[model samples]
Target: MSARRFLPGLVVLCLGAVLARGIELVLGANHLLVAIGLGFVLANAVGVPDRLEPGIATHKLWLGAGIVLMGASLTLDTLLEAGVVVVAVIALVTGSTIVVVELLSRNVFGLADRLGSLLAAGSGICGVSAIVAVGGAIRARESQVAYAAATVLLFDAVTIVVFPIVGDVLELSGTVFGIWAGVSMFSTGPVVAVGFAHSDVAGQWATVTKLARNALIGVVVLGYAGYYARSADGSRPTVRTLWDEFPKFVLGFLALVLVATAGVLSPDQLAAIENAYNWLFVLAFVGLGTEIRLTELRKAGPLPVLVVLIALLVASTLSLATLSVLL
Candidate 1:
């Protein structure tokens, strides 16, 4: 309720967004990436002053809200258009990444199972969101969750820049690059950014593929919750448990998707919604960047980072192979 804590943080975020826009106009940079880079520099170089901490904390809300609104872009026909093959590729990539990351964390890296699972979920599924969800399900330490989030952020920045270049160098077709981007990316925004930055066809395919991946977050989280419940307390999971654990924001996305499908909103209205989601997403990403404390990541040691890197490489390699077969 105090303005001192919230207002300062809000102002800094606005400044970051404005700066990102300026970079986009001048350099044709990806504004989301710029916002993240700007926030990282501000945080690491001079530190985000303590007064603005509260508003920065609100970024999670922004991330959720923005993602929900992003549902406006999805419709039933588009969803169906993604087809069975694309869905199969996504599932394969996700399952493979998680299994490989967990195995490496346990056998190769010699980390605890809880920490290993958190890292695996983050890298394999939806980055920070999946890490936080699975971490809670498995009762992972807060420190472990932070480390997993940081590790994903590191790759998020790297892949954001590198994916486009790799696609171009390989002269990848739009469909191939789209599948690759959707399966390999841990988050939707970066997938959209990289795909669109390359070509329109790639962007369209990426959005559908990524959304399909995102929709499975609830299923994946419920599975983890059930797995841990039976192991820890010997309680079998039930329908109620799955309902309680489901991500509500996904429902919001689905509602908006129905609205889109029903043709309830005019084109202009949908455009405005799209614009709103972009702003919210950029703001959330800026907050995410500021929250990353490099010191904590360093404390996480080499194993977790190595596991994430390897998992990413595996995901990338596997998705590429899948694209070869499908495309």
Candidate 2:
């Protein structure tokens, strides 16, 4: 590609990242949610001029890169600190949520089994990225993926904003509060920021807990991949199916986390890793925002929105209740 042609995309990437991070810092909250909501508003109420769509749409690649940086923040020590019981608790909460949502999607909502299962897993697993990966693997329709992503983004915003408030109201200890937030929130980025915004100790606990939760993504994906591949054939799976079905970025993401946690990397090196990760997050959110049709979301009617709200309520209730009894 010519330099002139590439420059516009490169510029968009930089600007979107800077804008997202700046907004996050200025808002001192879940600014990504705000940006997404604003994007929805602009696209629906006002308008995204046709000329600017391409630049905004290029954020998907950046989001991928951000995910990689997020892995760098993970360390073996952090995982170990979360403990067996905490791990078990997270497993149960996330696992059960997935199962319940899956059943609801199919039985109650009367959606197709595969798409319903994917949404349940995504919502109950690691949020948008998880949903996106599973959707690709199963060759899910655009509508399914959009609904799943919307579910995650909506709850993510709610959990990130509301969890801290509940923690304070309950007068929960820093450790218990952090663990609650960590286990409940689907995505690591917003949870970490929110936990830290509340307390340093809470931040530390939440980061460790969130990463531990994320580590399960690899396990879940691998399990699904293995099952699907084997069921397809006793031999090897086809390249087309495998490539389309599997999310290759996940392995790279885990590797980045492991390498950073291995104690070989210096502080300066870690800083570089974080920079790359943040940009990827920005890009991913941008892609999500770009693809979202606000009018369509509205037209999908209140049922989907109601489902999201119910899930959020269940998650929050479970989180704080768990903290009360267990902590």
Candidate 3:
């Protein structure tokens, strides 16, 4: 792609990122949420120019690359220290959440499989990142991707604030509550912010547990790709197709974990890479927001939100059950 052709979309994303940064600095809010919201406002208010569409289409690529860089922040030693309980809780929560959402999307929402799958990933696994990853794995349509993201962001924003308050009210210990937040919250940023808000111990535990959860995303996406290919096309994907469709960035992410565990990179170097990850993610969110049309989301109806609302309850119950053992 020529720089000239890509410049328009790049400019649009840069504007969105600037606005997001300003909002985050002023309000102490999640920048991705702000960026996406800004994108939504521009998309619904005036519409994006055709020149920017090609660049915006690269958001999934940005998202994938960000996930890879995110791995550098996680060390295998920390993962091991988190122990089997945390890993088990994450696995149970991730699997159960996806299953529940997928079922609800079909029976309750009457939604299509493609859109429903993205919602499952977004609400169940991580959020927009996981949604975009699974969306790419399945080759989901742009409208479905937007609907899934809009649906999750709506609920995730509320949890960012509410979870901390609830933890305080319950007077849960930092370790317990950190596990709760790590297992329950839909996104990484909110969980870390809320966990630390509760306590330093909670924050530490939350980061480790959440990173463990995030690492499982690749395996889950691979499973989804297999299931989707079989159910949608009536032919099982061959090894070649799986190799082609599987997210290579996830492998890169795992490699970074090894690098992080190796103890070669200085703290400053790792921090710099993390900052780069944030910028990449911001760009991705800006691209995502630019595509969201309020009109399209409205057409998707209230069921997506309903699905997320139900997920909150399911997540809470599962989180508490796991914490009971861990605590």
TM-scores of the candidates are: 0.83, 0.66, 0.68
State the lDDT at 270 in candidate 2: 80
The residue-by-residue lDDT of candidate 1 on 132-182, one tens digit each, is: 777766677888888778777777767878999999999999878987898
In Å, residue 147's CA in model 1 sits off its true spot by 3.8
Pairwise TM-score winner, candidates 1 and 2: 1
RMSD of each: 3.2, 5.3, 5.2
lDDT of 2: 0.63
Whole-model lDDT per candidate: 0.78, 0.63, 0.75
Q: What TM-score would candidate 2 get against the native?
A: 0.66
Summarize candidate 3's per-residue lDDT along 171-245 as a digit string, tens digits.
999888888888888776566556656765776577567766776667767777878776554233345644554
The Cα RMSD of model 1 versus the native structure comes to 3.2
**Residue-level lDDT for 89 in candidate 3:** 84
For model 3, state the Cα shift of residue 289 in Å. Answer: 2.9
Clashes of each: 0, 9, 0
Q: Candidate 2, which segments miss by more than 4 Å at Cα?
A: 1-6, 9-13, 16-46, 49-55, 70-74, 103-115, 127-183, 186-250, 253-262, 271-293, 304-308, 323-327
Top candidate when judged by TM-score against the true structure: 1
